[model samples]
Target: MMLDDLSARPASVGLVAGWSFPATVFDPLVRQLPGDEVVAFDWSTFSSDWLGRGQEERAVPGLGPAVWVGWSLGGSLLLEAVRRGRIRPARLVLIQATPRFLAEDGWPGVSLGDWQGLRRAAGRQPVAAAAAFRRRFDLPNEPAPSAQLAATEGLDWLARLDLRSQLVSIEVPVDIWLAPDDPLVPVDWPKHLELPAHVHVHRFEQGGHAEWLDHAASLARSLVRPLADDPGARSAR
Candidate 1:
């Protein structure tokens, strides 16, 4: 929606935030980027719209081959969108994003308390209670996406469409930044995901949930903005 007012720049970044976290969180990070960087996309709702909209029509204006950056759930979304061919990007950057969230009995990543707690809070409690539940779950140590994108009618459609095998189909370079102290996503989930050969990863010292934005700017200097010094580094790898 904000893109409607934005005039085209030679290149710009597009962002889709995690569930309910809001876009303002990225203002500091994006502002630090070159040019007048743009990175606010609709919240989880827009991702839903993209799903039922289908992979065939997922590209938004100015989003074609744009550098896609997201945090937590947003990170998973950028990659999934690529899997579905919903949108293509010049580069894909994810901070603390993982592929699968739900944990298997054997998987060490997520816990039943994490999943059920969400179900109870959102399903049983009112907005205030749900917000409180989200605050706790969204913690970096947790691993629940800062925002859940697939809960709505459209996003559910997206969730129904799986793309594990489709990750290889994406031609663009992918970059992942994981927080060592995350909450919702827990740990070990990152190990389970199979990223394309083009994917690159950087682990952060801190910034459990909102890392580069809320955690610390030092992390971004070396961890997030590798391209600032050389954009071709990822593709060359």
Candidate 2:
């Protein structure tokens, strides 16, 4: 976990990165965010205790009700945390995220064979497997060397966890950003799930899975707009 104090401004932003990639991969996007403080959580270190840790024991300290953002697998973790009453944020942003990653009876997602293949490869050769995974998504940065174990755990969670039924019950405001061209997450999957009235979905025409890499500035503006408009809004701590 890394915290960047951008300014003395009161607002803070917490970020969780996806599988295979390190938290530093969010540097570009974090630089563009308007928050005074930014906390980036690394999968390798944070995944182990994500659900077990208490609220005050979270990576972010004195981070009262900030805008929390998660991408890909990280988004699933965030959803799980919220569902379990782990962390509450003023707003939640999910990028290229889906409630479930593996294809179900009627859902569109990664095939079982492909998911299993990746899991096996990661078990045998994590570094090479992660490299191939990053190449497949055209991820911009290389993950830290210790991400091997975390990668396997992430795949397991992706295959086993499903949050479609939990979406409607979350009390926080959620903004889900989707890319129509994203190969990993199907844009049409949301149609199969029921979301709450506070949940809003936005689609971008370009930028595949790593939209933040291609459109960081635009995403930053969109992320801060609501906070800028409503400076007084605070989530339950």
Candidate 3:
């Protein structure tokens, strides 16, 4: 869909940020998304009690029949929310995300040793650990201040959470955007996992994990284009 088409019909767009980052990280991408009333969910807003709750009891407020976008860890959380019937979205978009973070017997993912080491580093020196992560992903050195406890909890979620089996059950139309060069999420996931027919996958040549930082305009366009052609998304609106 053209930018003009997006502006002609305004829709609600909910954005969920990745681990340790604030919603402000989406500012660049948000500016490129025209006519959409954007609602951002910050990691700081997630309390310990809320994070500890089961899928059915965990509630993500301010989400409705809108186009929900999530990045990395946020995407995993959204998948769980949808699977457990916590929220129903018109469309779901996952950016450089995966169903399982840690490597399993046949699944490709982060090594258990590496994941554990990162968690330990974050606990001992959060700022340094975050800086190292940003450098590894080619992200800005200092984007925003993250809540340490929340970030640690997010790491915990990444280590233990596995949603591979439930991914096919979600009824909403799903869009997964990935980059082969993304150091964090493995590019071979599509081949390893079984996705529902309704799920569409888009692979970019370059855009690492932080695509929004460099290709905000193009990313925003890609996000709305499919929705523009989706009759179900329009009808629900």
TM-score of each model, in listed order: 0.69, 0.83, 0.83
Measured with C-alpha atoms, the lDDT of residue 154 in candidate 2 is: 78
Q: How many clashes would you count in candidate 3?
A: 0
Worst 10-residue stretch by lDDT in candidate 2?
228-237
Q: Report the lDDT tens digits of candidate 2 across residue range 1-237.
A: 112332334357778888887788887878775445677876554556567655445645344447778889888888887777667687888888998999979999999999999999998888778878778877654545454544688788889888988886778899887876788998888788778878877776665788656666556655545533322222211
Instruction: Rank candidates, lDDT, best first.
Output: 2, 3, 1
Best by lDDT: 2
Shift of residue 26 alpha carbon in model 1, Å: 1.6
Greater-TM-score candidate between 1 and 3: 3
Tell me how far candidate 2 lies from the true structure as C-alpha RMSD in angstroms: 5.8
TM-score of 3: 0.83
Clashes of 1: 15
